[model samples]
Target: MPFTAGRGDASEEQTDVESFEALEPVSEVSEIFIKMDFRSFRGNVA
Candidate 1:
């Protein structure tokens, strides 16, 4: 149950990916961000 899933659109997810990709140079931070973001995407939002 992703926030994106409920929205039924690719635009929002694309923006999120673009934002995450902007952090690509920061491996450690990006990994952490991706992990936390993954959980958040899976609905562990808080």
Candidate 2:
């Protein structure tokens, strides 16, 4: 999705605002990144 400062598509802006409003707070710290092991990473070696 394009994050325009302003004067973008009106529908997209409205949808983004509505989606943000619908979110609720969570108690736990969210995992923003995935944890991986070195061997496991090697398994997907291309």
Candidate 3:
């Protein structure tokens, strides 16, 4: 999903823009991540 952890400077802002740029394509990846075991967030998780 075009995942990124941009840090320092204005990287968070830049990542927001980059995420929008990849929206259509990354949406698919995002959907996959949503269903992935590692990404699942149901209930209390550590």
Candidate 4:
């Protein structure tokens, strides 16, 4: 049971890495959106 639990932890780590890699692009897109929002806010204020 202990070995099985250890194996499960390893698999969970792998899945976490894969999901993080998949989110990289989405994070970039979010950054772009944040910048655009800030620019629009500035324009409106000015």
Candidate 5:
């Protein structure tokens, strides 16, 4: 979270990777919600 001027490009890339990895679980949760919504939608249609 703390970006220092001394670390420069390498630090920035590392931070980017860290942020991406942190979002991995969020992606999984969104997929689960999408599947649940689809199932409910199908139940309503039927």
Candidate 6:
């Protein structure tokens, strides 16, 4: 699977993983980052 961070941003973080075992940690960490970003954005908007 392939993933990218930050829409329309040139300096974005990205990753690709070929195996399920290798992808597990990446997926977990990605979920955590997404949640954190969402919370921070919500705080900014509120």
RMSD to truth, every model: 14.4, 11.7, 13.2, 7.7, 8.2, 14.1
lDDT computed for candidate 3: 0.54
How would you order the candidates by lDDT, starting with the best? 1, 5, 3, 4, 6, 2
Candidate 2 clashing pairs? none
Off by over 4 Å in 3: 1-27, 40-46
Off by over 4 Å in 4: 1-27, 38-46
Worst 10 residues of 1 by lDDT: 1-10
Question: Which runs in model 1 stand beyond 4 Å of their true positions?
Answer: 1-27, 38-46
lDDT of 1 by residue, 1-46 (tens): 6354454555664656666665456456446657556645545545
Instruction: Give residue 25's lDDT in candidate 6 (0 to 100).
Output: 49
- Point out where model 6 deviates above 4 Å: 1-27, 38-46
TM-score of each: 0.22, 0.17, 0.21, 0.22, 0.22, 0.22
lDDT of each: 0.56, 0.46, 0.54, 0.52, 0.55, 0.48
| TM-score: model 6 vs. ground truth | 0.22
The candidate, 1 or 5, that scores higher on lDDT is 1
- List of clashing residue pairs for candidate 4: none
Pick out the ten consecutive residues of candidate 5 with the lowest summed lDDT: 21-30
Our tally of clashes for model 5 stands at: 0
At residue 17, candidate 2 shows an lDDT of 68
Residue pairs with clashing backbones, model 6: none
Query: How do the residues 1-46 of candidate 2 rate in per-residue lDDT, one tens digit apiece?
Result: 9565865557664666656643555443322112222444554656
Reference-based lDDT, residue 31, model 4 = 68
How many Å off is the CA of 17 in candidate 2?
A: 9.5
